[model samples]
Target: MKPLDPRLLRYARGTRVYLAATVALGVVLAALIVAQATLLAHGITAVFLDGADVRTLTPTLIALATVVAGRAAVAWAQETVAVRSSAAVKSELRGRLLAHLVAVGPARGGDTGAVTTLITRGLDALDAYFARYLPQLVLAALVPAVVLARLLPADLTATMTIALTLPLIPIFMALVGLHTEAANHRQFRLLSRLSHHFLDVVAGLTTLKVFGRAGAQAATIRRISAEQRRLTMRTLRVAFLSSLVLELLATLSVALVAVGIGLRLVSGHLDLTTALLVLILAPEAYLPLRQVGAHYHASAEGLAAAEEAFAILETPVPARGAAPAPAGTIVFDDVVVRYRDRDALHLSATVEPGEIMALTGPSGCGKSTALDVLLGFVTPDHGRVTVGGVDLASVDPAAWRSTIAWVPQRPYLFAGSIRDNIALGRTPMHLPEPPTAFAHCFTGTVPDAPRPDVAAAARLAGAAGFIAGLPDGYDAALGDDGAGLSAGQRQRIALARAFLRDAPIVLLDEPTANLDTETAADVMAAIRRLAHGRTVIIAAHRPELIALADRIVDLAPQPVGAR
Candidate 1:
């Protein structure tokens, strides 16, 4: 990302507020720096040349001390505020990124490991960006201008010299920064790859061991780690070299300004006080810019990661129609999806309201893909899907989805109590209004509204028996993705969400695939109950599930250019 990306301001509201504070503080700080230098130069020149008494200089000393204290306070405030602003910006970015990913769904969200790393370790690098680099960036703009303005009235020679040489530091900084930014990008990309590869290994460790490929995977991880280490060292080397260059340029620039002041002072064209003030303020002019160059490297990785985040944020969400969804038959008219240079799905089908329609096909024939289309997770490359003669794409996704209760082939359960899982974080429905005469006496709000019956939903999904057997019953918490529960139990919990939802349309993907005969029979019975008076679409391979459908539509694999 740029030092002050417009997109950052657009995405993180905290950034605009923080930057305003920083700039205001920076202006105050610049004034204090000039005042401190002025007081010191005047006091020293008076005592050294005019032999002024100590008592006469007491006010000058006090003023100088106050300026110094004010500068310190500003510095402390900048640091304190920067830390808080960093946290707020990171939190805002993280929250927005996660929300977007969830809205888009996993189908187009990109790699899980890369996204995980970006949100965690990757964005954490921005601490350096905010805490150190950003404040200096503001000072770089303010301090140089203020110092030069002060010097213009004191020593025109020194002021002109500073102005002429000051541009050199930034010119060189930009050149070196280009290289540093490229190096940081490479480093961040490698780190992302390493994280993704390691995640893949851990997730499939059991399968790898069964296939006798565990050792191979371990060796691959070591190779990637070594490459990452090499890149890190290379980036650090560039940072150190760049820092040295900036320091040398700044030191030489200040030396040049000092030399010019010394010559003018010796020539009797400048006073001791003016020369001293020029010497003091000359370094201040270069200090902020020099520090900016140094801190830029520290923040480069974070900036690179921010660029990636912006890319995700800027990606257009498939335009959700603002119109509310209409009720009636759902139609897929020659829906076509092109994925990875081939046709993933090409189908046309229709289901009348309240009908149970089964989509039967072999793996890769696009049964799940078709269901995904219905769920509004994937838009077709060609053709259209409609409900009641209104285009589905022209219906608000949220409104349309409110009518759907989907259970995927591998259902994901969060780490939460069974009751919360069944409820899916839904708040209680608003309570009915009381009689008008008693309204003024009532203060209870929606939080006091009656919660839905979680146990009833569980019973409807055939999950009540298993849930009751657990020690904590409804309060029992599961690990990530329902870790402690069996596959059948997890599947039933997902079904429970559907029952609770009571949506008009139900979409099930292989709901009974992995269950034992008895469990499958129970699940099928629940499915029958769920399908009553609902428009049901089932993606299935099993004959038992196919039997439950009023009619079957078989999907055949389409060629790359198939119409």
Candidate 2:
């Protein structure tokens, strides 16, 4: 990323306001710096050269104190704003990033662990960029120019000297920045790899143990960790060495300006007051630039991570329409999807409303891809899908999806009470209790008073029996991704969700793929109930599941060059 990527300003609205504030503060800080230096120089010259006493120099002392306090106040204000702006910008960027990821869907969203790390720990690094580097950068641009402008009339020679040498700091910074950016990118990549690998190992630890490969996975994780440590140290070493170089250059420049001032004062070519003012302002001119160089290292990793985020956000999403979904028969008209020089799917099918249709295929023959096509996650390279002769592509995806209920082969269940997970975004179903005024009039308890709808849906999906046996029933807290539940239990919960959705169209993918015989029978029974009176599509490999369909469309893998 460049010093200030324009995409950030466009993608994160908070950045626009924050950046404007930063620039305004930079101007205020510049003015305060000049005022402080001018007052201090005059006070010192008054006391030493003019033989002024405390009583006569009281006003000068008072003005100097005021300027100092103003500078301190401005400094505090800048820090407070920086902290708040960092939080707002991160939140805005994170929100945009998550929305874009969802819009693109899972097919093209890349590795789950890598993206998880990026949105969480990855973007957190931006705090240094906003809080430290950006403020100093604004100061570097403003303070030096302000200081030089102040010195031009009082001491033209000092001003020229400062101007000519100041460029040296930035020149060296540019040179060092090129190397530092590459090193930072390398370090971030290793960290991402380490994070991804560790997450994968932990998620599969049980499977690794079953296969007697846990030791091998542990060794792999250790190797990646060691590599990450070495790269981190190396990046830090470069940052430290570059900070030293920038500091040394800035020090030499200030000293050079001081040496010229000293030479002129000795020759009586410069007055003491002017010399002192020039000396004070010269270091102030270099300080912001030097600090920018130092903070640049601190923000480098964050910039690298943001570059990836921008890349993801920039990916083109399949265009959707605003029109409502048309209802009738669903038709797949000679659809063909060619991916990576092989055909992912090719089909021609039709299903009348309220009919059950099954798509059967081998693992790589694109059964799931067919479901994705219906879900609008992927657009076919050729052919069209239509509902009652209206193009599916012309329908608003969200509106169309609202009319459909989908159960993926592996449904994701978030960490929450089971009822919340099942309800997802909708408010929990509840029956209003009798009014408080009539508290004593009821003779029997309200049937399913709290969440009658959820209970009814669970019963329809054959999940009520297991749910009632749980310690907390429907209110049981689930771990991440529905942990602490058996595979059959998870499947039942997903079916319960679909049942609750009650959409006109239902799409199920391998609904009984991993269940035991008895559990599969129960699930199949629920599936029969779910399919009745609904426009249902099932991507199935099991014979019994296929048998339940009104008709089957067998999808065989296409050979290479079969486009």
Alpha-carbon deviation at 361 in model 1, angstroms: 3.7
TM per candidate comes to: 0.86, 0.90
lDDT of each: 0.85, 0.83
Residue-wise C-alpha lDDT for candidate 1, range 1-563, written one tens digit per residue: 24687888999999998999999999999999999999999999999999999899999999998999999999999999999999999999998987787666657777867888899999999899999898999999999999999999877888899999999999999999998899999999988888999988876665698799999999999999999999999999999999999999999999998888888899999999999999999999999999999899999998999999998998777777889878999999999998998878888999999999999988888899998888788999999999999999888777777777888776766656777667761322111111110111222221221134678889999999999999999889887667789878988988887888788999999999867898888989999999999999999988999999997998876556764
- How well is each residue in 1-563 modelled by candidate 2, as lDDT tens digits? 23788888888788888889889989998998999888888888988988899999899888888888888888888888888988898888887876677677656766767877788888899999998998899999999999999999999889999999999988989999999999888888888888888888877676788799999988998898898889889889988999999899988988999999999999999999899999999999999999999999999988988888898899887788888878999999989888899779999899999999999988878888888888887889899899988898898887787778888786766666777656641322111011110111222222222377788888998989988999999899888667888778888888887888788899999999878899999999999999989999999988999999998988986567874
What would you estimate as the lDDT of candidate 2? Answer: 0.83
lDDT of 2 at 258: 90
